[model samples]
Every structure is written in structure tokens, then in C-alpha cells.
Target: MDFYLTALVQGLCYGSLALGIYISMKIFNIPDITTDGSYTLGGAVTAVMLTNNQPTYLILPVVIGVGAVAGALTGLIHTKLKVNALLAGILVMTALYSLNLTIMGRSNLPLSNLPSLFTLVDISTDTNLNTFWIVLAFIAIVTLFIGYLLKTDFGIAMRATGNSESMIRALGVNTDKMKIIGLALANALTALSGYLITQWQGFADISMGIGVVISGLGSVIIAETLIRSLSITSVWLNLLLVLGGAIVFQMVLAFTLSTGVNPLYLKAVTSTFVLLIVGLPRLFRREV
Candidate 1:
């Protein structure tokens, strides 16, 4: 039970990453690999700040800002320099590895002894329970904020910029600028996931974000599968499904581990699981 609970918390942590991926891949149709770097950037920033006795509230905005900058750089490279989207993301992600190392001054930073956002409130006697509620509340707030943002006039313009760039551009929308801002917003959310996970895991490692984008992609794909199967079109419901997908993805992994799968083979297992999620749906659809 405790193991599954921990996985639930982790799922919530990665919920932010799923949201970020949804914005980048689903909305903008850009497979931004910057997720790998910006995620660790958030953890790096959070770990450094917490070790230095920084307030949690103060550290969050800084994390978001730094993540946005990393994402915006990718967008700039893609839009202004005429780089392919994939290559631009790869360039920025490569650069962020060194930047993260420089920021941390080492390979890992421990935060076990430090006060964190999870410790700010005591909701239950069990530490895991408290962390669960804190994470849930934070995710809920973020989902609501994003859902509201997507319904506004500016948000509609941003969506338009992604759906039909030329049409939106002809209508006086700055498509390039929108792309930049969209990527920035996407990475900012991804960074927030890093912020939460670092504290939850009690340490931040330079390698923690490696291949992290796969989890996010898997979650988004899961959500997309459900959305298509159900023909759901409401933005709020879609956001909730994304969060649900993140949780389900993590839960599946937790179940796999519980079944005595070798830890060494976890990555391979994850890949296969994601492949099944992606391929099974298409196969069934084709058969039907």
C-alpha cells in the first residue's frame, strides 16, 4: 500500500510534466525535447535554493522563470534561426546539461534535512499522506489555472496560432511570438514538476531528468487515447484526463515493480509498456 501511495505522489508530481507535454505536443504540434533538461533545471534550482534556506514561495517563481527561459530559447532557435523544431529542442537540451551541472556544482544535491513545501502544512500524521494532499492541491490549482487560461481571448489566440499558424498570422496574430510564449509556458510547467519531485525524493541528481520526457509523452498519449475513444471535447475534462493519465502511467509502473521485475530492466519495461499503450489503441481501432 505504501509503495502504491508513493507512486501516486510521484504521478501527481509528473502531472505537471504531462500538462507541459500536452501544451507543447498536442496544442502546438511540436515535439519539444527540452523537457529533459528543463525538468532537471527545476529540480536543480529548487535543490539549490532549499539548501540555501530559501523560502518555498520565493523559489517557485524562480524555477518557473528559469524553465520558461530554457523553453523560450528552443522556440527562438526554431522560429528565428529557422532551425528544425526537433534540432532546436536538441540543441537547447544539450546546452542545459552543462548549465544544470554548473548550477548544482556537483552531480547531486540532498534536501532531506531541509524544510520543503510538503512540510509547510501538516494535514495528516502520516508523512506520505500529508505529501499526497499537498501535491494533490498543488496539481489541482495548476490544472484550474491552465484550464482558465485556455478559455480566455489570448489563450484562444494561442490555440489558433498552433492549429492554423498561417490563418492566425494573417489575422494579425504574431505566430512566432505565440510559439515562443507557448513553449515557455510549457517548460515552466515541466520545471514545476522537477521542483515537486526533487523535494519529494529528498535529493536532486544531475541525471534525474534523463529520459524523463518519455514518462510525459506516455501520459499524454494515454490521455489522448481516452479522449478519442470517448469523443470528449471539453477543455477542462481533457486536462483532468491528462492528469489521470499521468497517475495511471505511474501506477502501472508501480504495479510492474511490485510484481518483482528487476530494477535493472525498468527502463526496458517502461519502453515496452509505452509501446503497448501507443500501438494497442491503433491496432484495435484498425480492426474495428
Candidate 2:
């Protein structure tokens, strides 16, 4: 029971990242690979700052800003330099790998003394605030912030840009700016998740971002499958569904690990699961 509870909490953190990916992939219609790098960027920055005695509260905004800048750089490459959006994200992600290494000044950094938001909570209890509560808080805050942002005027414009670039331009909306804003918001959310992950785990490693993009996408796909039947058409529901998907994915991973599955083969299992889920919908359908 304790093991499942722990996995559930950890899953929430991972789910937060998946929600971020869903915004870019499903809502914005932009398959940005910047998530892989931006996630590391957040961890690197947070770990370094925490080691230097920075406040955890401030880490949130700083990580978000840093992530936005990274995403904006990718957007500029694609929109301004006319690079393919897909390739531009890859370029930014590649550059960020080195940048994260530089920020941490090493391959990994530990956060032993640094305070986490969970630790600072006013709940006076000997029991270390369980991972479940901490992750739940982060998820709640992020979901609320993102849901609010998506309901704003600019958010609507950004969605319009995704649906029809020419149409948005025809309406006199600056599609380039919208795209940039969308990317920034999407990646910033991802970075925030990375920050939480670092603090939760007590350390940050450069290689942690590896295959993260695929993991996030997998969560989104799984979430869509579960909540596709929901009557709620709002984007906020989609966010919740993605979170649900992440939790499920994490639980499955934990179960596999506990069942004597080799850790090294975890990625293989995830990949196979994602493929089955993605292909299953198409394998049985017939053309009308």
C-alpha cells in the first residue's frame, strides 16, 4: 500500500509534464521537442540555485522564465529564420543539452540541504510530507495557472493560430507572436515540472531528460484514451485526463519494477506499450 501510494505521488509529477506536452502537441498542434531539453534546463537551474542557497519559492518563477526563453529561441528559429518547426525544436533541444551541463557545472547535482516547498509547508508533523501531497499541490497550482491562461484572449488567438495560420493572419492576428507565446507557455510548464521533479528526488542529473519527450507524449496519448469519452469539451478536462494518464503510467512502471523487471528494460516496455496503444485504434477500424 505504501509502495502504491508513493508511486501515485511520483506519477502526479510526471503527469504534470505530460499535461504540458499535451498543450503543445494536442492543443497547439505543435510537436515541440524542446521539452526534452527544457526539462533538463529547469532541473539544472533549480539544482544549481538551490545548492547556492536560493529560495524554493523563487525557483518556480525563475524556472518558468528560463523555459520560456528556451522555447522562444526555438520559435524564433522556426518563425524568423524560416526553419522547419520540427527541426527548429530539435536544434533548440540539442543546444539546451550542452547549456544544461554548463548550468550545473557537472553531469549531476545533489540538493541535500536545500528546502523544498513541501518541507516549508506549515503542517507541523513528524511525518515527512508524503510525495503524494507535494506532487498534488504542484499539479493543482500548475493546472489552475494553465487553465486560467488558456481562457484569456491571447490564448484564444494562439489556439486559432494552431487551427489556421492563414486564417488567423487574415483576421489581422500576429500569428508569429501567437506561436511564440504558445511555445513559451508550453515549455515553461514543462520546465516547472522538471523543477518539481528535481526537488522531489533530492538530486538532478543531466541525463534525466533523455527520452522524456516520448514519456510525456505517452502520457498524453494514454490520457486521451481514457477521457475521450468525457462530455466535458473544455480544454481543462483534457488537462485532468492527461494527469490521470500520467498517474496510471507511473503506477504501471512501479508494478513492473516490483515484479523483478530489469530497470534497463523499462524504456523498452514503455515504448512497446505506447506502440500498442497508438496502433490499436487503427488496427481494427475499417474504412467506410
Candidate 3:
């Protein structure tokens, strides 16, 4: 039970990344691979700031700002330089690794003595329970804010730019700027996840973000399935489904670990599981 609760907290922490993915991949139609780097960059920045005894509240905004800048760079490279979107993201992600290393001055930073947002409140005897409520409250706020943003004209423009860039461009919308804003928003959310998880996990590793995008994409695909099944066309409901999906994904991973499989194969297993999630539904839909 405690294990599952831990998974729930971890999932909620990563739910922010899934929301970021939703904005970039699902809404903006960009497979912004910059997530891989920005995620670690967030943790690295936060860890460094915390090490220097920076205020907890100030670290998040800094992380978000850096992530947004990284994302905007990718957007500019893709839009102005005409680099392929995927290649631009790869370039930014590659650059971020060195940048993160430079920021941390080491491959990992332990936060054993630092005070974190999670440590600020003692909600329960069990640390996992405290994490559960605190992370859930944070996710709720983020979900509501993003959901509300998507209903506004600017958000609609971002969505429309994704749906059909040429059409939006023809309608006097600067598609490049829209892409920049969308990617910035997406990466800001992703960075927040890194910020929270760094403190939650008690350390920040340079490699913690490796392959994180796949996990986030899996959460997104799971949420997409649930939203469709429930006919939940409302923006807020869809975002909630994504959050719930992240929890489910982590729970499923915890269940897998409970089995006697080799822990080294976890990433391979995650890839297979995501493949099934993305493939099986379409296979069944075709059969029907």
C-alpha cells in the first residue's frame, strides 16, 4: 500500500511533464524533444539554487524561465533557421546536457540537508501521504490554469496553429510566434515537474531525464483513450484525464516492479507497454 502510494505521488509529480507533452505534442502538433533536456535542466537549476540556499519559491520561476528559453530557442531554430522540428529539438536537448552539467558542477547533487516544498508541511505521519496531497494540490492548480488558458483566444490560436498552420498563417496569424509560445508553455510545465521531483527524490541526477518523454507520451496516450471513451470534450476534463492517466501509468509501473522481473529491463518494458497502449487501440479500432 505504501509502495502504491509512493507511485501515486511520483506519478503526480510527472503529471506536469505529461501536461507539457500535451501542449506540445497533442495540442501544438510538435514532438518537442527538448523535454528531455529541459526536464533535467529544471532539476539541475533547482538543485544548484537550493544548494546555494535560495528561497524555495524563487527556484521554480527560475526553472520555468530557463525551460521556456530553451524551448523558445528550439522554436526559433525550427522556424527561422528552417531546421527540422525534430532536429531542432535534438540540438537543444544535446546542448542542455552540457549546460546542466555546468550548472551542477557534478553529475548529481544530493539535497539531503536542503528544505524543499514538500518538507515545508507535515500533513501526515507517512511521508508518501504528505507527498500525495501536496503534489495533488499542485497538479490541480496547474491543470485548472492550463485548461482555462486553452479556452482563451490566444490558446485557440495555438491550437489552430497546430490543427492547420497554413490556414492560421493565411488568417494573419504569425505561426512562428505561436509555435514559440506553445513550446515555451509546454516546457515551462515540464520544468516544473523536474523541480518538484528533484526535491521529492532527494537528489538530482544529470541522467534523470533520459527517455522521460516516452513515459510522458505514454501518459498522454492513456489519457487520450480515456477522454475519448468518456466523450469528454471539455478542455478541463481532458486535462484531468491526463493527470489521472499519469497516476495509472505509475501504478502500472509499480505493479510491474512488484513482479520478479529484472529492474534493468524497466525501460525496455516501459517502451513495450507504451507501444501496446498506442498500438492496441488502433488495432482494435481497425478490427471493428
Candidate 4:
């Protein structure tokens, strides 16, 4: 139960990033790799803030904002400067590598002495509050917020832009602006997840964000597989599926750990699992 709980929390953290990826990949029709850097950017900002004695409530929002800015910059690089969207993401992620190092003032930052949100609350010492309740609450709130946003007029425009950029442009929608906003929103969510994870883990490693884009894409694919029964695929259902997929993915990880799997092979395991999950549905559908 303890291990499951821990995995659940970690999965929720990853799921939050999945939601961000959904916005970019699904809604914006943009395959973004900036998440790899933005995730660490969020952690770096949160660590720096905590180290400076910033409050938790403030830390979370500020870190999210920092993430939003980073995402917007990436979007601007693509839309405003006429850079290819894919190349823009790579450029931004590369720049964030140095930016994160500067934010932490080193290769890593440890929050051993800092007062985290979990430590402030009256929770059992045996279990981290984040895994059990805080993470759950955060997921719920973000899902609802993004769900609601996607149902609005601006959201429709963004989705339309993804579906058919020329059509949306003919409709008088500023595709560039929409792209920027969508990208900003996506990275902000990714960054926010990083912030919570940093707080929960008590430290931020520079390499923590490696392979994050694959993780997000994997979660999105897994969620689509699990939510096949849902006919009306809206933002709400998509977000819920993301939450579910995150939990499922984490459980798989826990299963691997219990079987004494080598930790060094974790990425290979995740990549292989994603490949199977993605291919399985298509293979079965072909027979149908």
C-alpha cells in the first residue's frame, strides 16, 4: 500500500505534465519538446524560492508563472520569429538548460532545511501527505480548471487552429497568438508539476527532466487507450483519462520495482512499455 501510494503521487505529478503535453500535441497540433526543459525550470524556480524562505502558496503560483513565461518565450520564438515549431521547442529547451543551472546557482539544489508545504501540515510521518491527498487535490483542481478553459471560445479557436490552421486563419483567428497562448498554457502546467515534485522530493536534480517529453507523450497515449469507452471526448474526459493513465503508469513502475528490476533500465522499460501500449490498440483495431 505504501509503495502504491508513493507511485500514485509520482504518477499524478507526471500526469500534470501529460495535461500540458495534451494542450500542445492534441489541442495546438504542435509536437513540442520544450517540456523537457520547462519541467526542470519549474523545479529550479521552486527550489530557489524555497531556499530563500518563500511561502509554499506563493512558491507554487510563482513557479507556475515562471513556467508560463518560459513556454511563452518558446511559442514566440516559433510564431513571431517564423522559426519552425519543432525547432523552436528544441531551441527553448536548450536555452533552459543553462537557465536552470543559474536558477539553482549550481548543478543541483537540496531543500533539506527548507519548510515545504507537506512538512507544515499535520500529517503522518510514515506517509508523505503529497502522495495521499495533496497531489490528488492538485490534480483535481487543475483538471477542472483546464477542462473549463478548453470549453470556452478561445479554447475552441485554439483547437480549430490545430485541426486546420488555414481554416482557422480564414475565420479571422490570429493563429500565431493562439499558438503562443496554447504553448504558454502547456508549459505552465508542465512547470507546475515540476514545482510540486520538487517540494515532495526535497531536492531538485539538474538531470531530473531527462526524457520528460517521452513520458508525457506516453501518458497521453496510455490515457487514450484506457478511455476508449468514452464517446464524447471533451476536455473533461481527456483530463480525467490523463489522471487515470498517470496512476496506471506508476503502478506499472511499482510492479517493475517489486520484481527487482534494475533501476538503470527504467527508461528502456518506459519506452518499451509506451511502444506496446501505443501499438496494441492499433493492432487490435486493424482486426476489427
Candidate 5:
């Protein structure tokens, strides 16, 4: 019971990044690999600031702004320089690695004894239980903000830019600007995940975000499956499901470990599961 509960908590932390991935890969139709770097950048920034005794509340906006700047830089490179979006993300991600290293000034930074965002919360007697409630509250606020954003006129225009770029452009929308804004928002959310996870887990490591995109992709795919099966048209519900999918994804991993699978093969398990999630849905649609 504790194991599954722990995974659910872990999922919610990573779900922030998952939401970002959904925006870039699903809505904007861009494979923004900037996720890997920007995630670590958030952690790196937070870890350093906290080490210097920065205020906990201000970390939220500062980390989000930093992540947004990273995303915007990638957007400029792709839209202004006409580079492939994927490559632009890759370029920024590569540069960010060195930058993050410099920021932390070391490979790993530990915050085991430091004050944390979760330090003030006393929601539950058990540490894990308290962490769960804190993370839940954080996610709820973020989910609502994103849901509301998607229903706005600007958000609708952003969606159309991806769905029917020609049509949106014909309507005099600056599609490139929309893409930039979309990517910026996407990465800001990713950074928020970093901020929470770093504080929750009590440390930040350089490699924490490596290959983390798979988890995000899996969550998005599962949410998409739910959207199709339920015929959901409401933007808010769809976003909520995406967050739920992240929790489910983590539970699946927990189940795998419970069955005694080697920890070394966890990534392999995740990849296979994601493949089926993505391919099986299309296969069923085609057969019907």
C-alpha cells in the first residue's frame, strides 16, 4: 500500500513535466527535447538558491521564469532561424547542460538538512502522506491555471496554430509567435515540476532529468487514450486526465517492481509500455 502511494506521489511531481510535454508534442506539434535540460535547470537553480537561504515562496516564480526564458530561447532559434524545432531544442538542451553544471558548480547537490517547501506543511502524520497532500494541492492549482488558459481566446488561437497552421495564418495570426508562447509555457510547467521534486526529494542531481521525457510521453499518451475513449471535448477534463495518467504511469512502474523485476530494466519496461499505449490505440481504430 505504501509502495503504490509513494509512486502516486512521485507521478504527481513528474506530472508537471508531463503537462509541458503534452503542450509541446501534442498541441504545438513539436518534439521539444528542451525538457531534459530545462528540468535540471529548475532543480539546479532551486538547489543553489535554497543553499543560499532564499525565500521558499519566491522560488516558484523565479524558477518558472527561468524555465520560460530557456523555452523562449529555443523558440527563437527554431522560429527566427528556421531551424527544425527538434534541433533547436537539442541545441538549447546541450548548451544548458554546461550552464547547469556551472550553476551548481558540481555534479550533485544535496539538501538533506535544508528548509524545504514541504517543511511548513503538516497535512499528515506520516512524511509520505504529508508530501502527497502538498503535491496534490500544488498540482491542483497548476491544473486549474492551465485549463483556464486553454479555454481563452489566445489559447484557442495557439491550438489552432498547430491543428491548422495554414488556416490560423490565413486568419492573420502570427503562428510563429504562438509556437514560441506555447513552448515557453510548456517549459515553465516542466520547471515547476523540477522545483517541487527537488524540494520534495530533498536534493537535486544533474542526471535527474535525463531521459525523463519517456515518462512525460507515457503520461500524455495515456491521457490521450482516455480522451478518445470517453469522447471528452472539454479542455479542462482532458488536462486533468493527463495529470491522472501520470499517476497511473507511476503505479505501473511500482507494480513492475513489486513483481520483482530488476531495477536495471525499469526504463525498458516503461518504453515497452508506452509503445503499446501509443500503438494499440491506433491499431484498434484502424481495425474498427
Candidate 6:
């Protein structure tokens, strides 16, 4: 039970990542690999600030800002330079590795003794339970904000920019600018995940972001599958489903670990599971 609860908490922590991926992949049709770097940038920034006794409130904005900048750089490279979107993301992600190291001044930074967002409020007697509530509240706020944004005229334009770039551009909606802003928003959310997770886990390592994009992608895929099956069209419900998908993905991993699989093979298991999620749908559709 404790293991499942921990998984639930972690799933909530990654909710922001799922949403970020949804924005970049589903909305903008970009496989923004900058997720691998901006995520760690968030953790790196959070760990450094907490260690310096910075308030949690102050750190949140900084994490979002830094993450946005990293994303914007990728967007600029892809748009202004007319580079392939994937290659542009790869470039920014690679650069962020060294930049993250510079910010942290080390390969890892521990925050076990430092104050963090999880330590800000005590909602329950059990530590995990308290962390769960805090993470839940934070994710709820983020989801609401994103849901609201997607329903606005600007948000509609952003979505249209993704759905029909040529058409939207023909309508005078600077498609390039929309892509840049969309990527910036996506990465900011991804960074927010890093910020939450680092504090919850009590440390940030330079390598923590490695392969993290897979998890986010998997969650988004799961949500997409559900959306298709149920024919869900409401934007707000779609966002909530994405959050649920993140939790469900984590729960699946927890179940795998509980089955006594070797920890070293965890990544392999993750990859296989994601492959099934992505491939099985097409395979079944082909049979029809």
C-alpha cells in the first residue's frame, strides 16, 4: 500500500511533464527533446536555490522562467534558422547539459536537509500523505490554468497554428511566433515537474533528466489512447485525463517493481511498455 501511495505521489509529480508533452507533441506537433534538459534545469535551479535558503515561492518563478528560456532558444533555433525541429531541440538539449552543470557546480546536489515546497505546508501526519496533497494541489492549479489558456482566443490560435499552420498563417497568425510561444509554455511546464520532483525526492542529479522524455511521452500516449476510445473532446477533461494518464503510467511501473523485477531492468521495462502503448493501437487498427 505504501509503495502504491508513493507511486501515486510520483505520478502527480510528473503531471506537469505529461501536460508539457501534450502541448509540444499533440498541440504543436513537435517532438521537443528539450524536455531532457529543461527538466534538469528546473531541478538544478530548485536544488541550488533551496540549498541557498531561498523561499519556495520565489524559486517557482525562477524555475519557470529558466525553463521557458531554454524552450524559447530551441524554438528560435528551429524557427529563425529554419532548422529541423528535432535537430533544433537536440541542440538546445545538449547545450543545457553543460549549462545545468555550471548552475549546479557539480554532478549532483542534495537537498535532504534543505527547505523545499513539500516542507512548506503540513497537510497530513504521514510525510508521504502530506507530500501527496501538496503535489495534488499544485497540479490542480496548473491544470486549471492550462485548461483556461487553451480555451482562450490566443489558445485557439495556438491550437489552430498546430492543426493547420498554412491556414493559420494565411489568416495572419504568425505561425512561427506561435510555435515559439507554444514550445516555451511546454518547457516551462516540464521544468515545473523537475522543480517539484527534486524537492520531493530530496536531491537533484545532473543525470536525473536522462530518458525522462520517454515517461512524459508514454503518459501523453496513454491519455491520447483514452481520448480516442472515449471520443473525448472537452479541453478541460482532456487535460485531466492526461494527468490521470501520468498517474496510471506510474502505477503500472509500481506494479512492475512490485512483481520483483530487477531494478536494473526498469528502463527496459519502461521502453517495452511504451512501445506496446504506441504500437498496439496501430496493430489492432490494421486488423480491422
Best by lDDT: 1
lDDT of 1 by residue, 1-288 (tens): 999999999999999999999999999999999999999999999999999999999999999999999999999999999999999999999999999999999999998789999999999999999999999999999999999999999889988888999999999999899999999999999999999999999999999999899999999999999899899989999999999999999999999999999988888888898899999988998999
**TM-score, cand. 2:** 0.94
Global lDDT for candidate 1? 0.96
Clashing pairs in 3: none
Residues 1-288 of candidate 6: C-alpha lDDT, one tens digit per residue: 889999999999999999999999999999999999999999999999999999999999999999999999999999999999999999999999999999999999998778788888989999989999999999999999999999999999999988999999999999999999999999999999999999989999999999999999999999999999999999998999899989999999999999999999988999999999999999999999
Model 5 RMSD to the real structure? 1.2
TM-score of each: 0.99, 0.94, 0.97, 0.94, 0.97, 0.99
TM-score of 6: 0.99
Candidate 3, 210: how far from true, in Å? 0.5
Q: Enumerate residue pairs that collide in model 6.
A: none
For residues 77-158, write the lDDT of model 5, one tens digit per residue.
9999999999999999999999989999999999978988787779889988988999999999998899889999999998
Off by over 4 Å in 6: none
Q: For each candidate, what is the lDDT?
A: 0.96, 0.84, 0.92, 0.87, 0.92, 0.95
Candidate 1 accuracy as TM-score = 0.99
Comparing 1 and 4 on TM-score, the stronger one: 1
State the lDDT of candidate 2 residue by residue for 1-288, as single tens digits.
767777787788787688778878887788899999999999899999899888888888999999999988988898899998899999999999999999999998998866886676755353334556666877898888888877898778877788888998999998888878788888898898788889888899999898888778888888777666456567788788888888888888889889999999999988887898788866766532
Query: 5 or 6, which is superior by lDDT?
Result: 6
Candidate 5 versus the native: TM-score? 0.97
List the candidate 5 regions with Cα displacement exceeding 4 Å. Answer: 286-288
| lDDT over C-alpha atoms for residue 203 of model 4 | 98
Instruction: Assess the local accuracy of residue 82 in candidate 5 as a C-alpha lDDT between 0 and 100.
Output: 99
Clashes in model 1: which pairs?
A: none
Q: What local lDDT score does residue 63 receive in model 4, on the 0 to 100 scale?
A: 79
RMSD of each: 0.8, 1.9, 1.1, 1.7, 1.2, 0.6
Order of the predicted models by TM-score, top scorer first: 6, 1, 3, 5, 4, 2
